[model samples]
Target: MNVTITTIYDELRGFLDDHQVSTNETILEQHSKDESYHTPSLPDIVVFPETPEQVSAIVKVADKYNTPIVPFGIGSSLEGHVIPYDKGISIDFSLMNKVLEVREKDFLVKVQPGVTRNQLNKELKKYGLFFTVDPGADATLGGMAATNASGTTSVKYGVMRDQVRNLEVVLPDGEIMHTGNLAQKSSSGYNLNSLIVGSEGTLGCITELTLRVYGIPEHIAAARAAFPTVDDAVEAVVSILQAGIPIARVELVDEHSITQVNRFSETDYKEKPTLFLEFHGNEQGLNHDIEFTKEIVEDHGCKEVHFEEDNAARNKLWEARHNLAYAYMHLNPGKKHMVTDVCVPITELAGAIKFARKRIEELGLLGGILGHVGDGNYHTSLMIDMDDPEEMKRAAQFNEEIVEYALERGGTCTGEHGVGIGKMKYQQREHGKAFSVMEKIKLALDPNEIMNPNKLVHSKRRSL
Candidate 1:
């Protein structure tokens, strides 16, 4: 390594202990990429910081060297959001993990950025509260906030950005700033919390957060409804939501996905297009919702609807849904996993998914369709053999076609997964003139383009 970069290693060691800084090849490889199929790139060094002050110090040093700073938080992101394409300092936040406080009366919790959603929920269980922005993976809260992640429960509980009430962020120039306060609502200055939540580490580094939580519901019921076709299942979601059932989670898993899930989880779920449903409410209310949902699905051509009466069964049902992607990965051992996230208007969802399914068949690719249909968001989890150039090209074409289709309508290229390297090309097409505004924000906040460069917005410092 060059002398200048080598000096950064020494400076980082000075900020923390010697053990906190790593030039080890294994650690560098681990920090190189996330769960995406995007190509991996290594950072020059990885430094573990335990406090916001330490994070600020690391940022200052990165700024001094004009080096890129990619924040690491378990590296569970699927869009290559944390890859360090421009070899520099990677700030690993695993050591900063801690649940600082749980205010049960206030229904809020203060936690360090490294704390995962599962970890926080575990602690909140003692207080009969739960953090609800579950994006399938046990991803670190910091990473989830960076990506504005959402999954099955987003239809009711909302995304990570919604739960976030405050953030302790370290700016590109090493200044510590709080985006919001603990108040229930705010009409103050700009909604910096919203801006930073989905910034994908381009604007600032989140060191700590104050998040909103919900009390455990008195009654919970989960069910799996089988449909003859994917269209029927998606249409049923629209109907259920339009009926105002307050469904906690409604997911559409296609026949192919169910096959993979059954193979991986060893559960006989009747290999067919199905809708995984859940409702949270009082006993009487939940019963009414379930009955109402059953009527709506039957009207839309549901073949069979089965409810999980026990907690174990309910957990297993959701577990299979959450592990659906891994199921694809497991069954197709040699191929990489790439998912297309597109969300459309509720009315347009059925048609959009139909188009995606058609394209998948036309392209002759190996993949499955899954949707958080309650919110009109779905993903096509594709398995591709990277070595096969023709197959890779077809997969790329499929992604582009579906993304363009979503853009042509009022939908986004990415519903939940942030535009990392994977979806960066679609930004201009999706945002039009407003994409320039995003660029200006990136330039203003990160003039040197040091914070998680080459992922989100592209500035003059780097080309997309």
Candidate 2:
């Protein structure tokens, strides 16, 4: 809008084609917000850069103009991670979508940041290989690494940070930096991989990545167990983990979520608290694991337990689980979703889930509880009418209460979703004296405040 910003836009058009650099209102609106319930704000410009060199060129321009940079993926993130509040430039990475290399022998793959999980998996399937980190939605690998995202498979494989071995990052001041080597373990320098993984774009923009992949298991199995109460299902999960059975994925879908899934997925799963479980092993080992898991869940009051060995049945079961969120949205037509992600230690998970349900019922909120329970992380997909002040207030209170509870129990306010604008208020509470250390790192990496400003670090309790 001003002369300085106007000059930067003119120069951007000069370097990139007219189509690559856009000031159109429709494109700006599309890049404005993520899938979160947070209010949307448009960026002044949206640029799609196809190469890391182009990213560097654009970053240099942003530095010259002192403009903000908010990297955009597929907008699948639920934490407002990509909102361009200051109306600077939004760098949409969709154009950089490509898998550069797939090393089947080393179990590694190099890809651009814009490549989605589904896209990468489809390519990897040829060599009997697959990327392990799956966050349900078809989010860009760059965004997933930025958020350190994890979903069902995290229990056995770990999160995005674990899968990432190398990162090609474009810094705030127009410099390119790589995080680490492809070695399985490293003890050399400052461990930049961990630092940048969950930074929520506060430090820099990710341009490329070398990720760890996995071979398809020799044999695979899936199961669904029904519990009479939420507490029972949670307890069963805790027991299974305690027994140290190597379960690949264990998800909790409550009765409310089940009913919603049935409505949208057109499947008749019993409307009860249930655990969708999966195992990865050889045929003999998988059978042994399934039997042991069965014994443990039954001990914790699991009434009905069923297993699926056929590939089609297993895929369908996971598909339904992934579509549960859409079901909730479909049921709540005009309402906005306020999703919560809190993870506690295994010992404290059952109590925490029970408390969350009690509070939700007491507040009379329309919501459902589901999550990757094996890792002690859970989410409450709350649907609320944003226009209703009373409902909004209750949702805020419920979120705060659960966060406080998780913190008191030595848990994190965010399990998978990064501290984009959504969890900024909880940073100091969760990290305490160490939160300032984070601020120092943020400043050291992004001193100009050009990369996704007002996000994870270098700020106190503030709204975006």
Candidate 3:
């Protein structure tokens, strides 16, 4: 028997303390969508749980009612991971924000799922340590783990999956379980930690995360190298990685993005395809690496290469890169951003990006290309009027074409973003038989299909 929305709301209100449950339309609408172009679906109710027991109790209540429960953190996901499409309950984790422990000696930090990256970093700074996975936004650590997020530093520090030492999960059935222990390495049975990391909240809700941290590097330097063409800049990245330069971050911002950055940042960067690169190590090591990188970039037809030695200048350089998405938004004031992510082998990156640029031009879309090129991942941010059907259709076609191209080249549809609602159609094509295995796991874990249903896996659309 399906419970009515009013009944569920009343039950939730009865179980929670003041400020724990809300049925206000404005708050419900706020929890309905993420930062994507997907249509928003308002949940009937929103609830915040401050402890693992509370989270488990809420899940149990939803299970009894056979109502959908969507776990949300900061609502910063670029895909539709947090959307409560079935008009059920949205479990916001904001109240659970806490940094429980910081094991400085062991290089690990334990935090509640609601803790944002910036919040954790602030506490880690006193210990001279930092977390590596930065997903552009100051998103929650749990959301980062959910999407297996990777960012500018991924080429060196790896993604969210790599940094996670353990996870405390509240399963769909309200069963509390530990994915793994704090051992540095394990040769145990199945890798549940990894399975839950990128499951997009379909398998379970992460309550606490024990993450690996890094010590502050001895020396750091930032550089900007402008190339005659995007192809040249991509090739330079390939050469740098092939030569084993331990670059902390290597991002590519195309000519269009450079123009947007100039407008948004109030700085005059050359309006050309450029590589924003950073190196971290001892002074001698960084100098040697920079020298080698300069030679490689110049060989690839770099027009201008400048290094920033001052800390303020280096921060300014990365701040510009981090703000590229907002810059695109600023440049196109009235349109929504439709970003596409595809990752290929390093050798094939230049060709893929070149093809994307030509395709964007052919489609007559106003967009810019920029991403962490060192990891063979790139994104094209397009500004589109969401209300215009023709423009939306064209954007969909463009995304499909790019994903198909990447798959044809043995690449992935998404490098950092998981298979949320937007990427669902490509899963079967991307994973084939393995896709069935994923569905089977989903059934085993969430038989009622209550945990973020219609996401990551395809199921018949059901009405609330």
Q: Which of the two candidates, 1 or 2, achieves a greater TM-score against the reference?
A: 1
In candidate 3, how many Å is residue 186 off?
A: 0.4
Write model 1 residue lDDT over 345-419, tens digit each, in one string.
877887887888889999999999999888889899999999999999999999999888888889999999989
Global Cα RMSD, each model: 1.1, 1.5, 1.6
Error of 2 at 449 (Å): 0.8
Cα misplacement distance, residue 291 of candidate 1 (Å): 1.5
Error of 2 at 138 (Å): 0.3
Highest lDDT scorer = 1
TM per candidate: 0.98, 0.97, 0.98
Residue pairs in collision within model 3: none
The 0-to-1 C-alpha lDDT of every candidate, in the order given, reads 0.91, 0.89, 0.90
Candidate 3 lDDT over residue span 366-426, tens digit each: 8989878988899999999988899888888889988999999999999998778888889
Off by over 4 Å in 2: 458-464
Root mean square deviation (Cα) for candidate 1: 1.1
When 1 and 3 are scored with lDDT, the better candidate is: 1
